[model samples]
Target: MDLSKYLGLFVSEGGEHAEQMARELLQLEGAAVAPEAIDSIFRHAHSIKGMAASMEFSEITELAHAAESLVGALRPPRAGSVPRATVDALMAAAERIAVLIRERGRGQQGEGKDLTLLLRGRAADPWSEPVAEAIPLKVEPAVSLRDRLRTVRVRGETLDELLDVAGELLLETSRLRELARQAREPLRAALDESVDRMHSRLRTLHQRVVAARLTPLSVLTDQLPRHLRDIAHQLGREVELSVAGAEVEVDRAIVDEIADALLHLLRNCIDHGIEPPAEREAAGKPRAGRLRVEARRERERLILEVADDGRGFDTKKLRAGAVRRGLLSIAAAEELSDQESLMLACLPGLSTSDRVTEISGRGVGMDAVKNAIEGLGGTLAIESTPLEGTRFVLRLPLNVALIQVLLAEVEREVIALPISKVLAAIEIPSGHGRTFEFQGDEAPVYSLGSLLEWKEIAAGSAAGRPVLVVDGGGKPVGLAVDRLVGQHEALLQPLAGPLGQFPGLSAVTLLGSGRPVFVLDVPRLLEA
Candidate 1:
């Protein structure tokens, strides 16, 4: 039978086996030898070698065979203990197999000679080249940042400065269009069309600049497994860390901004939540605690959750601790809801540990984590149950450069409100009162033109007018407009130079008709 039809199955199964091999190797380090673990790995490697040999992939067959021998040498009837070097070499071989499997998945040929020699005790020096470096990962030559980074390093600031100048020049062209509008109607229309064509090109350039700055979440999470292993070793704890959805890409600036926050949260989980191996066994749980880091995309936002199956602290204790530490008075602590009390853990100088350690328990880690997330226009939430578990959730924009905006017409001037911040959009009938009932309470509504006072226009006696329910810092507020212009995807371009002087506007965008529209910073506008 021809083996060509089984290519996909072999690659998929080979990948899973390699992953199991890596995890088993990680378990062997800093722990007692287990013949069962070695046996399981040997079986997986043997299966891979058999499949590769059937498929006539000699390079992969040789690599898997070498790794199988290494694992077999550490099993019973031959050895009683596992050598550290064997585990290291086997781990490298597993890494090589994983790379080779990925190449098979992508229809590429990869050579694993260096790692195969290192595994079978033939190479003079094992560390001369890493498995990841043996065969370079393929990437498209054009537009791939991997190719560009290999030759040159560019700073994000320099990119932003160039974009700002380009944006300013675009605005200057808009000013010139105003002069053209004063000429004859025929000549004015021709000039407007030319400007529109020019604007289209500039917008494409702006989009490229924005995309070039995006960083993959994998870049941020690539070293997480090794980092978690090192931290577990330091804390003298047994933790199994698993990560998911590391392929999502986001603004590089957001990645840099939240890197420390992610680290602090991870450190907190290991330092405080997980119990010692003996304590965990006594508590009727597994000796090793489970820690999960997951990232997923929902609409326009990236939701990141870090959860741990360990002993969670009590919010009652947090409330009492707040009172004891003098961070809050007795009455204030009593009035706080359980969720609010849970957040008090982020307060400086408030820690659950009885003694301070270098890893955490100084009380500043959570505070910094919260602040960093909030600085990126994201919210951080905490949920825990006593003696059960704790989960920290971060909800942030997937792309800060682009936003889904609700376009509305106010006195004939188009405006936008970020959809992420809007609660709902509704229609009001004619003869309705100024106060609309929402959630059993009356929410005061005002016309958008009345609030912004632009051209002193209003939607008086009009029916089917649009009203937006916006989040006004915990409470909802109603803002009605003359008409609904529907929703649109827009780039939140910078307002530089003369355009920067416009108050109460967060960003601006150009419509398909070449008309410029401003985004209302609703809270700021209301405050002013």
Candidate 2:
């Protein structure tokens, strides 16, 4: 029988099992290895092995069998902590199995060399077991049926299409309400009530659809511990990795975009932040350095922090490095405060490392991390205390597609300012404001019309034009607009083609009236 039909199932189920095993192997490295953890890992390996054998994937099956044997020996829990070497071997085997599964899914045959060497190397281990007799596998219908009922995985593209349809329906619903308001008295009242109910239902449906796109942060963070373990081993450092707020959910798309940036940050912590065991002990700290990755939601933003209690960044060294790298003049570097000096670390090709290594020291790390975070329409902040720790904070929008914005009329054009950036909207009295003082620092205020170079048609008095105090970087600036149209939920769409590279504008949104307005890129606009 052709096993091609089961390809999707194998890829999905096999991936989940592999992830589970990887997590359990990391846990097995702890001082106390739980029997349940071992059992869970064994079951996952056994399941994958059986599935691969059924599909005639010999490489994957052999690797899974080897992993299963190694884990099986740890099942009885009669020894000290699981050996680091055993965990490394199992992790490598699992990775190879994952690769083979992906290759088989692509209709490519595995070379089968890696598994041969891996198994041969493990053959002499005391825990190694003889290949067992094949047992006919039996599937329980009830368990299978219940699992099927529990969850269904849908492609992200399908959800995006559904959201698009829902958004269009919402727009049409808004149009109907507007039309109903203009109808004759009796009919107008009836239509208004009906439209209200319809609008409410549509809003509810839109919210649920948006919620469906959210995946817990744990889905991305679960593999991090294993990664940290590998990095620590490679660097000969003893680092303890802990993660919090794993249950916090954000858009799946955002998670995928930020994964690589987070990986780089974690690696930087291992290579540059965390000190070796002996150094950490000499510093009066624990032998195992502490690294914590935490995520949480604050109103419209998701705050992700990666903190390490190791050797924090040295601002003086950073300033010297910046000057040496020609990114800054010596006089300019000398004038920078501690905070400004620390920011120099994000400069490209500015490393303080005396020697180059595989992980870092080429000085291409932090700048890329900052760029990646900013590319997601987010901000990155760094805080460090020498010998205490270094914390990198990333503030990202909770959802990129839908945003709450303050709709304002700039001259004849309507523009959207993300409400998260708007601190307050106030009216400046005539002769009372050409600049707004915020926290004892005054910043020049510009009208939205002036900023866009659109002349006022009627030259109205500037007695009480609305001034929106907005967070521009860390400083607040006031933007004067003709009128505040009010708050709205806008579906953000990126500009395409020629307009894609526009500096001050990040995205466009369609209003309920089907009018498209540009969403200001606050940080970029401030820089410009």
Q: Cα deviation in Å at residue 205, candidate 2? A: 1.9
| Candidate lDDT (C-alpha), each | 0.74, 0.77
TM-score for each model: 0.56, 0.60
For 196-292, candidate 1 gives per-residue lDDT tens digits of 6565555556555666677788877887878888888989999988889787677787788878888888888888898888999999989998998
For candidate 2, list the clashing residue pairs, or say none. Answer: none
* Candidate 2 C-alpha lDDT tens digits along 170-287: 7787678768878999999999878776766676677667778989999889999898898899889998888998988888888988898898888888888898899989989999
**Could you tell me the TM-score of candidate 2?**
0.60
Q: Model 2 off-target regions past 4 Å?
A: 1-150, 168-199, 411-413, 423-426, 429-431, 434-446, 449-462, 469-478, 485-488, 494-505, 510-516, 521-528
User: How good is model 1 by TM-score?
Assistant: 0.56
